[model samples]
Target: MAKAKSLKAGDKVEWETSQGKTTGTVKKKLTSPTKIKSHKVAATKENPEYLVETEKSKKLAAHKPDALKKK
Candidate 1:
């Protein structure tokens, strides 16, 4: 099995969207359950998620490490 990628703040990443792929920079790492813009995020220390800001729209979204690709 392929090892999952490890991401950190300031890392450039991209993910799939309805309009196509969206690129952004990692703003923060979430290790605890929390909400972002009304979206519930289930993150834990062992399996954390990322908060990224879109380069174009500056929108924030939470994404799992595996769902993001370094850009």
Candidate 2:
């Protein structure tokens, strides 16, 4: 598997979802994996995480660093 990403709050990012390409802001960084929309996220202290809220939908989610791109 590829390495996870490191992100900070207030970062702009893009991600692919059922709704298509979506943009959002990083809300929080998680040290451990958490459940978002029934999906299990694998997060660790070394890799860390970012909890993002979708710009259009206003939905909150957790995503791996590799799953997101800085924009």
Candidate 3:
């Protein structure tokens, strides 16, 4: 299995997209239930999620640590 990435705010990361891979910067770590982009996120301290902003579009999205690769 692939190792889980330890990401932090301001860290550069990349994830898969329909167009291909997109790069972004981590905005924050979500450790509690919250809503993002009108979608409900079920993140917890033990299973946290990350909020990232795309470099090109500057769009915000949430993703799991395993889904992100440090750039």
Candidate 4:
């Protein structure tokens, strides 16, 4: 098993999407539950959400830390 990473803003990460493996930069770290880009996300307790901006399109989306991979 692998350990999870605590990502911060500006960190580079990759995630799997419909478009394949997409790379992005961390834009924001959510401390409280919030909605991002119409996606209802919970950032609390054991799960926290991160706002990531895609490197290619510069699109911002909210995702769980587990969805991100350090690059």
Candidate 5:
């Protein structure tokens, strides 16, 4: 399999949603379990998730690194 994308904060990325694909900039890299809004984010140091702000709505959401494609 190909290597997973290494994303960092401020990186422009895109991910798929129910509406379609959306673009965003990475706000932070979650390296530990944390809560955002009411959702429990189960991120870890080895396997991390990104907090991103959507381009259109500017809403924050957590996404797996694999789910994001660098732009």
Candidate 6:
């Protein structure tokens, strides 16, 4: 696999979903464990997750760096 891209807030990114590909904007980088609603974000400084907001639904989600493609 390719090296994961570095991301920050306001960066555009995309990821796959059951509904197919979805696009969103990075809201924040999670360096420690956190929660999104009832879902626990198992994040770490070495393996962080990104909080993103969907362009359409505006729903919030957390995804690992490798799981997101920076655009």
- TM-scores for every candidate against the unseen true structure: 0.88, 0.74, 0.90, 0.82, 0.90, 0.91
C-alpha root-mean-square deviation, each candidate: 2.7, 4.0, 2.3, 2.4, 2.5, 2.1
| lDDT over C-alpha atoms for residue 49 of model 2 | 72
Lowest-scoring 10 consecutive residues by lDDT in candidate 3?
Answer: 1-10
- How many Å off is the CA of 60 in candidate 3? 0.6
Superposed by TM-score, candidate 2 places the C-alpha of residue 47 at a distance from the truth, in angstroms, of 4.2
> Ranking under lDDT, best-scoring first?
6, 3, 5, 1, 2, 4
Q: After superposition, how far is residue 55 of candidate 3 from its true place, in Å?
A: 0.5
C-alpha lDDT of candidate 6 relative to the true structure? 0.90
Indicate the residue-level lDDT of 9 in model 2.
89
Model 2 clash pairs are: none
lDDT of 2 at 8: 79
Give, for candidate 2, the lowest lDDT window spanning 10 residues.
1-10
lDDT per model vs. reference: 0.87, 0.82, 0.89, 0.82, 0.88, 0.90
Cα displacement (angstroms), candidate 6, residue 60, comes to 0.5
Of models 2 and 3, which has the larger TM-score?
A: 3
- Model 5 spans with C-alpha error above 4 angstroms: 1-4
Candidate 4 residues 1-71, lDDT tens each?
22227888998888899979998898878878887668777788477788899998989888887888888
Cα displacement (angstroms), candidate 3, residue 15, comes to 0.5
Task: State in Å the error of residue 53, model 4.
Answer: 0.3
- Runs of candidate 6 exceeding 4 Å displacement: 1-4
Query: Where does candidate 6 have its weakest 10-residue lDDT segment?
Result: 1-10
Which lDDT tens digits does candidate 1 get at residues 24-47? 999989999999878899999998
Residue 55 in model 5: shift from native, Å? Answer: 0.5
Candidate no. 6 TM-score: 0.91
Better candidate by TM-score, 1 or 6 = 6
Clashing pairs in 4: none
Specify the poorest-scoring 10-residue window by lDDT in model 1.
1-10
C-alpha RMSD in Å of predicted model 6 compared with the true structure:
2.1
Q: Write the per-residue lDDT of candidate 5 for residues 17-43, one digit (tens) a residue.
A: 999999999999999999989999999
Candidate 3 per-residue C-alpha lDDT over 2-66 given as tens digits, one digit per residue, 9 for 90 to 100: 33377889988888889999999999999999998789999999999999999999999989998
